[model samples]
Target: MKILVIRRDNIGDLVLTTPLFRALRQRFPEARIDAFVNSYNAPVLAGHPDVDQVHEYTKGKHRKGFSPGWLERLGQMWRLRKEHYDHVVIATPGVHPRQIRFARFLNPAHITAFVPPGWKMFGVDQPVEYLGKDRHHLLMTYRILLPFGIEGDPPAPRIAFTPPAHSPGEAPVIAIHVSARKPSSRWPEERYAELMRALHERHGARFRLFWAPGAENDARHPGDDGRAARILASAAGLPVEAVATNELEGLIAGIAACDAIVCSDGGAMHLAAAMGKPVVCFFGESEAHLWHPWDVPHRLLQPESHDVADVTVDEALAAFDALRQEANAA
Candidate 1:
């Protein structure tokens, strides 16, 4: 069978859908599994053992209200028609009437999608209200697609990427992601520095810092921490390398390279968790139970009160210390 899965969203959302890819391949060993994803996340599917093809869409640019150009949409429709897919599944939310209309235009044997609380899943779900909570969106989406006759289990979010592997002989490593795009999401840099200091005292030179590439522009621009590089330099006390270049594949590889990750609650944290890498994620303005790493040796540090900043360096350090102990025990 030929199958097409659409998950044109962010890096984190794409990572969450990989488990579904694996499950689909396992069930239909002879099937072709293709994904339509945002351009930024297209690379994440690189070297995935299960996927046969990947199509990229420029939705981020299209969202700014520029002409996506009718020809581009026409080209996609033509490609889908030519591929002759037997099944099509849209894992992304906000499935428009037009999207469903187009899928029906192709005459796929099955089409599955998820609709929010008040919305209807016209062809499937028989138009049930989606009352599930947040973060469970990934699971809910997978469940919705299953009834369309796609054979697969609810997959634990796992990403596949080939990185320069480490020898088992190396000392235990600690991975850290010290920056985030949004200020409200970023933990104070000094807090990171202090945590690094504490970690160095405990692990010495064994720790490594992995940074999201392209973040340098955010750090170097005049308004964005003109001295951010130097600040991170002083704080981390170790050379930070750009492992993930704002692409899904690189992000997955970078996370896979690490034994554990200390990150703010963002795409990287989600990627790390999906890889089954132990994670210590700091949170703000989000619930830990909803977003924290699942089924992993993990800890979530969210603010006690209304202010997310209330989670101090001390609390974060304490969490790190606990992770370290777990590592040693393992």
Candidate 2:
């Protein structure tokens, strides 16, 4: 049997779909599993052991509504028509009519999608209701893949990549991803710097400070802050280094090799959690119950409001200290 899992969204969305990949692989060890992912987030699944192929779907590249874009869509659809898939799973949360049409275009044996109760549709059966009251988004999506006999615990999504070549005896490190793709989710830089200072003072030679790829450009706080760099210098005990490449896969491998990570509620924290590393993550304004890292000794500091800066520096430090204790115990 062959399967194609389609999730076309941002990094976090792609990350959430990884457990489905693993589940399918476990159930059909010999079957080929392909992931249809957005081009920007393709690297997250590049080296995943459970995935046999990575199919790129460029957003807006083939989207034309009866205009000049129609031809491009025709070409892309023609390419998709060539692949014979035994099953096609649409894992993206938001329902798009075009996705159903695309699945039909694949001419698969069957397609499974989520449709809320009272939702009526044509040519689609077995509507899977949104799993209510289950907060974690990744876990919720994993359930949709269950009917195909891909059962059991959906392990947290993980990425596998080669760590960048490091100089000999590089110090133990704590990666800090201080930015979020959404501006409203960022924690204050002053607080982050203070936590770095505390970690440096406490751990001394054991801890190095590092910034994640794309953080410098992901979200910008007003005043053109150099807080991430400053914190690494004064609070981090060792000179900072960039990953060999800015690719998300390389970033995950680098984080996996770290002693721990301190980050806001973003893709990096999810990666760390999936790697089973100790993580201290801040959450504010976003839904913590839904997006928080899973099954790891993680500390979540949430703000009362949407502004992540509202989560005080001391609160985050307390979580960090707790995570350290947990890591030591483990």
Candidate 3:
């Protein structure tokens, strides 16, 4: 069977859907399992044993500096249509009408997706009634494959990347990501500076600071250069090196090379989980249970006030200490 799984969303969302590809490959070993993803998240699947190929497209807004010709896009669409996939799984949660229409044009023998109660999602051969809460759970995306007789606590996410070499007695490297896509999730850089001092003193840890690149004032993709600068300045004497990741793949490689990660709940946290690294994550505004790192050793601190800023530096230190203890015990 030829199958295509479509997941066009944020980096974390695409990572969450990775388990499905593994399940598909296991169920039909001979089948061609390809992915239909956006350019932003396509690198996540690089070298995935289960994924035979990736069909990537950039959204109109994402085509700022690099836009593939319309003829190229048309040719890609035509080739997909010619493939005549036996099954196509809409790997997103809601009934996206535009994507639904797009999937219909592919002329797959069967299409499966989650449709809300009242909405009749045309062309979806198998519509799983979407439970509102399912979207929030990290592994709940697996429900999309139930109709195909695949069921399990979807396996941990996997990303293929070579990690940097590590020595025996050197201090463990920790990836510190300063990403605040949502305003409420922003944590002060001073607190991060304090935490870095404590971590280095207490655990003898080195740091690789990762963050959204580009100017914070960039209209299209506003990032955290200003915040990262402040955090670096505060840690002048510490072993905190800024990791310049110009591409999504570079970020993945950096995380995979680290021993652990400390960051606010976001794509970075999810990527760390995928690489099987321990994590100390902060949850604010975002639901803790929904987006928490899955199947990995993690401590998610979401204060009752529901703000990351409200979380203390002492709390972060304690969490890291605990993870280290767990490792030593193991």
Badly placed stretches (over 4 Å) of model 2 are 61-73, 118-120, 131-133, 162-171, 205-239, 242-245
CA RMSD for every model?
3.9, 4.4, 1.7
Q: lDDT per model, in order?
A: 0.67, 0.70, 0.87
Q: Which ranking of candidates, highest lDDT first?
A: 3, 2, 1
Candidate 2 lDDT over residue span 54-75, tens digit each: 8875567433354565566578
Candidate 1's residue-wise lDDT over 1-330, tens digit each?
A: 998887877777787778788878878889999987877777768768889989876764434456666668679878787888887777765445666676666667777765566765556433323446644556656665556455444767766654446776565566777656555566766666677776667665245555544434553421223234544666654535534334445556666776788888778888777767778887776656555676678888776652446778778778877986886798
Q: Between candidates 1 and 3, name the one with more favorable lDDT.
A: 3
Winner on TM-score between 2 and 3 is 3
TM-score of each: 0.82, 0.83, 0.95
Model 2 residue 146 CA deviation in Å: 3.3
- Stretches of candidate 3 exceeding 4 Å from the true structure: 65-72, 118-120
In candidate 2 the C-alpha lDDT for residue 229 amounts to 61
**Runs with alpha carbons beyond 4 Å of true place in candidate 1:** 60-69, 93-98, 116-129, 148-153, 163-169, 205-228, 236-249, 306-308
Cα misplacement distance, residue 20 of candidate 2 (Å): 1.0
lDDT of 3 at 256: 85
Rate residue 14 of model 3 by lDDT.
Answer: 87
